[model samples]
Every structure is written in C-alpha cells, then in structure tokens.
Target: MSTSDMQDANLQEALVTYEKLQDIEDDMDEVEVEILRQQDKLCKDIYAKRAEVITKIPQFWPLVIEQAPPDVDEYIQPSDSALLLNSLVNLTVERFELPQGDPRSVSIKWEFKENEYFENKVLEKKFWWRRARDGWAGLVSEPVDIKWKEGKDLTGGMLGLVQKVWEEEKAGKEGETEAAKKLKQLMEDTGLGGVSFFAWFGFRGRKISAEEDKEAFQKEQEHRQARKAGKETEEDAMDEDDDDSDDDEYEMEIFPTADDLAVCISEDLWPGAIKYFTNAQEQDDMSDIDFESDDEMDEDEPEGDAPANKKRKA
Candidate 1:
C-alpha cells in the first residue's frame, strides 16, 4: 500500500477509537446521574421515616439520651439544666458510601442550636458490620465525639492548661502519661492537635485578653438573662467586636471541648483538666468499643492510583 494511504487508514482508526471512548464516558455519566437520583430518593425516604417515628413518640429525647455514649452522659447533664432538652436542633442518620467497591457507612449526627460560644455538634456512635462469609456477626459502635457549646471562647484557657499539662508530662509527674494519652486522643478525634492545629492557627497563637475575658463574662450574663427572658439576641446583635476574622494578630481556631471547658474553670486547672481527659478516655476502655473505621484498618496497603480507590487517612 502507498505510504499516504497507510497514514490515512491509521488516522481513521484513531478517530474511531476516540469516538468509542467518548461514547463510554457519556454512558458512565448517565449511569452516575441515575445513581445520584436513586440516592436522593433513598435519603429523603429515610429522613421522612426518621421524622415520623420521632414525632409519634413523646419520649423521643429520653430514648436518644439513653443511646448517648457514657462519656457524653456527664456532659449532656440529662437533668433539667441539660442543653439537649431545649437546644437539640436536629438529629440525622446519613449514609455515606466509601470508595466504589467498599461498603457504605451510616453516621448519626446531632446538632444542637448554636449558642454564644462554639457550635455544639455530636457524632453519635458509628456502627458497621464486619467482613464475614455467612450471617452478620460483628455489630458494634465506636465512641462518639461530642463538641459542646460554651457560650464564649475559652480557647486561651484551654491552651494554657494544655501547655501546663505538657510541662508536667515532661517533668515525669505522677499520672501524666495517662493524662497525656487522653489528651492525645481528644486532640486527634477533634482535629485540635499538631498539623491540624498549625493549619488553623499558622505560626501565631491566640490568647484572650483580660479586657476580652471581662467582656465575655458580661456577654455570658446577658446571654443568661436573654435565655431566661426567652428572647435570645442574634449573635451579630451582641457586639461588632465579635468578628474574630478581622483580628490579624491572633486567630482563635480550635475551641475547647466540654471536658476542656470544665477543666479551664476548675481551680487546679491543668490537674483537673488532665483528670477530666483521663476519665473520658477510661470510659472508652471499659466500654470495649472500637471507633476506627474499616478504611482505617490497613495502614500498609499500597496507595491507589485513582481518587475513588484512595483510602482516607486519619
């Protein structure tokens, strides 16, 4: 065959291959769209069912409270003063599929009405089935991470306590190791440690000023009065200085957990904080629960080439 004719034939074959690839991509796109629609319908149905069940039951809060992890029980303060009773804005069970071939996971998230301080969020116990050949066997829940609203920023006090604890741990003080472990766990769970912390604050650290502390206390008093009067003011209405974004010198990134909040206010600060941290950690040990997900199982697995195949790191 002539060289020109051979070249033309090769070009025609390449065009055909390109067209086929385009057709496959189009078909895959259509399938993905259909899958999304089905997922949307399923989610809506699940939400509706959940709402109906809760609405029908007058003792819904009690059931939910009972289901809460033991560690959170103290923080929940199930008595009349408990925020869960009045501020529980939402409770949802949402299913999230892992990368294509992996099994899906359903997580229960509870969001309380945001108060003056940090936003209150709770990730309820995560449950999953073990990989087995026969009938379902391994059914358990992981320790839930709960973030409580403090009505004001106490990050400075918490950070101070953290530094004090670190110094004690360095000095080989009694019970410091156990306290350190609990602190580490809390930090890892809440993304308040190491690189995550650096990412939020960069090289600079935030410390609430004396004046700001006084202001915070004043706001708390006002907040309490507003709550009592049943007329909570919008956060923006409280003060123009409330914007943390404009403060170029120090940016408060991580907020204190409920446990940390208690310790910060305690007279013995660091010692009390360590005790609170250790107690919460001990609860998980006695409970015999594993919170780590399946994706977090094999650390030595070869990394996947595609985003869908990649395992998320803790």
Candidate 2:
C-alpha cells in the first residue's frame, strides 16, 4: 500500500479504538451509578442519626456552612453568612427519589428557625440527575424560592432577575435576550460571580421538558448501543456532530457555573460537613494559641521597639 493508504488505515484503526474505549467508560459509569445507590442505602441510617445529634448542637449546621470549602464559602458572603448563622437551624441531604425514580436525585433541605430573613421555615433544593438531550447527563435543578423579608434580601435581586429571564424564555424569547443581558450585568455588578451563594437556590441550568429529555435520552442510548456494536449508520455519523454542538449552548446559561457548584455541594459540602466543622474548631484553637504567644512576646519586648521592628520588617 502507498503511504497515503497506510495513513488512512491508521485513522480508521484509531476511530475503532476510540469507540471501544467510550463503550468501556459508559459501562463504568453504569457501575458507578449502582455504587452511588448502594452508598446511599448504607449511609441512610448513619446520616439520620447524625442529623438528630447535630440539630441539637447550637449553630452546628450554621458553622458548617460558615466554614465550608472555598468553592462553597465563596458563595456565603458576610451578609449571607449572617442570615444563615441567625436563621439556619438544620440541614439534611437525602435521596428523595431513591428506589422510586432516580437514586442520584437529592433533596438538600435547609431548616430555618423563625428569623427576620424570610417567612419560610424550610428551604429545599432538589437536584435531579436526569438524562437530557444529546446523550448529556448531569445534575440539573430548579430554583427554590426564598421569601426574604423586606430589605433583607442577600442575593441582591439576582434571583428575581434570573426569574425574569426564565419568564422571557418561557414566553418565547431566547438566546441572550434583554432579560438575560440584565441578569449577566447584575452578576458582574455584584462582583461575586453569582451574587450570593443563597441565590444558588434559584439556579436553572437546563430548559428542556421531561418528555423531551426522555425521548432524547432514549435515542442517545440507542445511538450508544449502535456505536458499541459497530453498527452506526451514516445518519448516526451525521447526528454525532449535532449532539456535541448542543453542549456548547449550555455555556450561555444564566447560571453556567451552577452545575459545578452543585457537585461541590453534594460531594464536598454535604458529605464532609462534620469534617469542615471540626477543621473550623481546630483553626480557632490554633488562632487562640497564636494570639496568646504574640501577646507574651509583646510583653517580653519593649513597646517602644515596635516601630523599630516594623521598620526592620519592611
């Protein structure tokens, strides 16, 4: 064969190998789903017990939120933290649809005591791990409504702006409409990327109906099966590009980063809440010790020499 013929053969060989690898990865993902289901079953009672104990501790959930990982803490501004510390009483994450619909679906319930922040006693955000169009599947959630008291809104009007954009989209406006531009401008003006972490409750990432998602998901599965069996039709080959192109459209979402934020909550914030609280305690203790040591050193040294020391440090 000529050199060109050999290159063509190599390209074809590479494509076949890539399809085989994708098939294996898809199978691994299925196993992962089962593992998640089993993990929930194993941890249900443990989480329930912990929930009972932690709720008794004053500000347990509040401190957990206050000392959350950077990815989460960045959302909890001082104002938002104040509301949470004052009102947030208990938080629980559960597979609300486990063994019924999707095991991966979680309801993160935030129980609030009576406070000036809002009227609702409990705020729950459910993240449904449903399949969407174009073989894409991840956590998608609807925004929860947080009824704030007059002049107590922490999200800086972001939730309302997002709702306006959604309303416009529902009313037939699409693709970076005027409302979306305003939403984007509000995010920039807030300088927090997402206004407040509390605004996360109002994030709506995907816009497809359940019926459409289900139909597309079925077609995606069929396409995957065809690829795995090396029975992909010419039509399937053409549709492959179209499927990938839809993914880029998600970036235009009003809350494009919300999906990543969701992962941080489910994986790091909820799963490791106790650990974060413990870490906060440890850091506080260390800070106290350091402060004491600094005081002792200050006393041992002359106060008049502080300026000299500062000059030397500079």
Candidate 3:
C-alpha cells in the first residue's frame, strides 16, 4: 500500500476503537445512574415506613384520651372532707354509666393527686370502664381510701372490683331494695343534669336505714300514684284539702348513690362528655393487607402492587 493510504487506514481504526469504548462507557454510566436512583428511592421508602409506624403506634391511645374531658385540678384538690366527698361523687358518677355497658372492664387505671385532703384523710382514686348506650364508657374514679400496697399493682385488681360492682349492680344483687332502686334512678337523672352526689356528703360508709328507706320509698310511690290518679272525689275532696293543708308534713329526703356522689362533687364536670367508644370497620379494598402487620408501610400501600413484594427500603 501507499504511505498516504496506510496512514488513513490506521487513523480510521483508532476512530472506530474510540467510538466502541465511548459506547461501553456510556452504558456503564447509565447502569450506575439507575442503581443510584434505586438506592435513593429505597432509602426514602424505608424512612417513610419507619415514620408511619411511629405515627400509628401513638394514635390509638391518643384517640381514646381525646374523647375524655380535661381534668379538673381545682375541683379534685385533696382535703379530708373533699376526699370523702370526692369518693362519693366519683362512685355516683361511675354509676351513671352502670346501667349502660362496660368501659372499665377493659383497661382500668387510677391516679391520685398529692397533698390534697379533707380533714386529715388521704385520698384514693381510680378509673374503670362502664356501660353506655354507644359502646364502652370510660370513668376516672375519684380518690377513695388509698389502701393500695407497695409492689402490689392495683390496676388489674381494681378492674376486678369494678367488674364485680358492675355485675352486682346489673344483676340487682347489691341494692335490690326498693329504696336502692329509687335512689339509683334519682342519681341517674341528677347526673344527666350535671350534679354529683359525692360533693354533698363529706364522709363515706354512711348506711341508709332499710326501714326508713323503704317507708320513704313507699311514700314517694304513693305520692306519684296520687298524682297519676288525678284530683280527688267530692267526698275525698275534703281529705285532699286536709292533705294539702299538711303539705309540709311530708319531708323530702335525698338518697344518693355512689355514682351520684361522684357526679355531685365533680360539679358540672365532664361537660360534653362522650357517652362511649366503638370499633370502626376496615375498608373492603384494604382487606388484602394483613391486619396484624407490624410494618405500617406494607399495610398502607395500594392493593395493585405485587401482593407479597416488599418495597426496597429508602
């Protein structure tokens, strides 16, 4: 070959080699870019997943807490008299939810304020579930006698006691007497009116006389029946007039329940209180997600993606 032709051939070969090398380098660059993009996406996804879990973990309890009314610190102050009063009030308020259903049965907790007392008595308080029209109702029992021992967690035990009280009240086992029923009904009505029975009576352990209570109940029933019967006959008219003359003869007695006492002392407390809590249903489209999955990201994703595919961590 001629020198000019040979030189041209060598240059052509070098250009072809350089072009091939450039193509390979471009492919590698593209692959590396793709890998880096995937890694960045994975890191973002992992971070989002972790954040979702943390957010959900605190959600359930906060929802429950939100439903409850704010605490009344001044009203809940400790005093020998106030403690006893609060005990009664708390018990009475607790009863309002009694005829309804169980809130305290699930998770019962109690907290007492420090340095508040009536006279020289230490306050005792508790919280428990009670029944309501909506579902389970929640109650924070006012301070009672603090006999809770050290190292002996009273949460579960107190729950049991509340359950027992609930059963007894439900079965009409504890206070089946006519007086008790009348007292219960009165307390329920009064509680709905924003009154607490505990604030009225300062001390606990006061027993109503069964005989007196029964007689008083009977008198109240007679009065109600009389009112229902409407006016009086001509012959009985004179007797009616006589009864009216002695209108002040029948003294009105106030019989309070433990629940009543609670409501009374609390004093218009629990305003706008929610009656109960209920469980909500999951959506049909979301059914594929395992209800028990610990990873919220896995649970929250749309159903269209590969059902078993674990998204790369961000």
Candidate 4:
C-alpha cells in the first residue's frame, strides 16, 4: 500500500479502539454512580431504623440486657454502688458522615440522661461503624468513649468496677467463677446490693418484668406468623379488653426481626450501633485537586476547565 493510504488506515483503527475504551469508561462511571446512590440510601435507612429502636428504649431495653454476652455481668456494681440503672430518663443518637476517607464509615453519638442524679447531668458515648466483612452490612463499634459530669466524682466507682473486670478478664479465660460470685455477695452484704446494672454500662437496663417481656415477645412472633398464614391471632379475635390492658407505654420486642438487628449491628448485636459512608462530593473534590497536582501540563496548554491529568507517553 502507499504510505498515505497506510497512515489513513492506522488512524481509522485508532479511532475505533478509542471509542470502545470510552464506552467501557462510561459504563464504569454509571456503575459507580449507582453504588453511591445505594450507599447513601443504606446510610439513611440504617439511621432511621436505629432511631426507631431507640424510641422503644423503655420497652425493649430489658431484652437487650438479656441478650448481652455474659461477660457484661462481671462489671456490674454491687446494686448499692450509687449506680442507679433505673434512673435513666432518656436516650438519643446522632449520626454523621466523615469529612474524608472510605465513605462507608459513620460516627454515632449516644446520649443518656438520668433524672435523679447530678441534676442536669448527661452521659455521652461515641462509636464508629461500617459494613461487615462476611455478612449483611452492619456496624461494629470502635473503642467506646464515655463522658461524665465534672466535679461529680461519681465515675470512680464505675471505673474501678470496670478495671477489676478487666483484670479478671486478663487473668483468667474461664466464665464466672465462685470467687467472683463471693466477691459480689460480699460487696452486696457490705451495702453494694442492687438490681441489674446494665444501664451503668451504657445499655438501657431492663424496665419491664422479664417473664412479661418474654411472653409479649412470643405473642408478637406468633402474630407475625399468623399474618404470614393469612389467619387472625386469638388475641386479635378477643382483642379489645386484652389489648386495652396493654398500655401504650409497653413494647413487645427490642427488634421486630433478627435480620433488622443483624443489618443494624451485626449478628452479635451490640447495645447500640454506628456506621459510616463516604461523601462523594468531597471525595471528588479531593480527587480533582490530586489530579491537578499530578498532571503534566505544557506551557501552551490553557488551564481553564481542563479534564483530569492526561497520561504522558514514556
């Protein structure tokens, strides 16, 4: 072929290859956008669901305590240690997006208040979470942060209790020991006896009777099963009086289903959860700045509205 004809054929082939590459890039961009949308939606859904669960604190808190890992019991203060779990007045949560990195991590803040102690004082806790490695998306807390009132001098007892638990944990891998139980009873006899101390550990303690809570939880499960079978529950048929006895102040379950709890805080279900998500807009801005810094520009190239760094030939 003539040199001019060969040059034209080469140009045509290059154009076709470039078009194919552009199509692949466009497809990738679309997929990335979809992923971002799904991530944002998941963040919002997790937040709303967590908030809903928080609202049921009064009813479901007991269930949460019951489900706690046994290790938690070791840290409980002798019920008389001025740590009043029943004094809890309310629970609140805050969720926020990170200013940078791995858009999926969310920071959550939990605030707990006590009506009877250190008037106007609040306990604040913070944790971070994101998707899981092996299961449905769920949050796992980092190290916990707790803030107590200043000048109250009340935290020492709780801190000491935690320290002792940690020491015991470090010294032995066995479950609750007779020595531990004796120490607890001695503390109680010496005026440390009290009710369940889960609240002091930042978990809302059981407010309802366990037996009643269990029965109610079971009823809810049965009700759901009946619905799935397209049948009305016996309680639904004889409803008015029995239902009337159930005050609005009651909650049957902390979580309606295992899946919701799992997605919110993993299968182990921490007392609370936090999750993270990257802010796409911030990420893009940072990328743009990085691209500009790394780009190789010629003196003749205008800086106005340029695309990202163009790859240079070796």
Query: Could you estimate the TM-score for every candidate?
Result: 0.26, 0.81, 0.23, 0.27
Candidate 1 wrong stretches, greater than 4 Å: 52-110, 114-116, 119-314
Candidate 1 lDDT over residue span 218-288, tens digit each: 56456445644545344434233534433521222233243222222221321132344455456555444
Best by TM-score: 2
RMSD of 2: 4.3
- Model 4 spans with C-alpha error above 4 angstroms: 1-43, 53-57, 71-74, 78-84, 89-108, 127-154, 157-267, 270-314
TM-score of 2: 0.81
**Ten consecutive residues with minimal summed lDDT in candidate 1?**
195-204
Residue-pair clashes, model 1: 1
Per-residue lDDT of candidate 4, residues 155-239 (tens digit): 3333334335435646875676554455445444544333233223321111233345446545655655554565533443444
State the displacement of the C-alpha of residue 204, model 3, in Å, after optimal TM-score superposition: 3.6
Superposition TM-score, candidate 3 onto the true structure: 0.23
Ordered list by TM-score, greatest first: 2, 4, 1, 3
**For residues 180-293, could you state the per-residue lDDT of candidate 3 as single tens digits?**
455445444554232222232212222223344446445544544444455321211235554453342111122123344344323333222222111111222243354445
Clashes of each: 1, 0, 46, 12
Model 1, C-alpha of 141: deviation from truth (Å):
34
* C-alpha lDDT values of all predictions: 0.41, 0.74, 0.35, 0.40
RMSD of 3: 35.9
Model 4, C-alpha of 308: deviation from truth (Å): 82
Q: What's model 4's overall lDDT?
A: 0.40
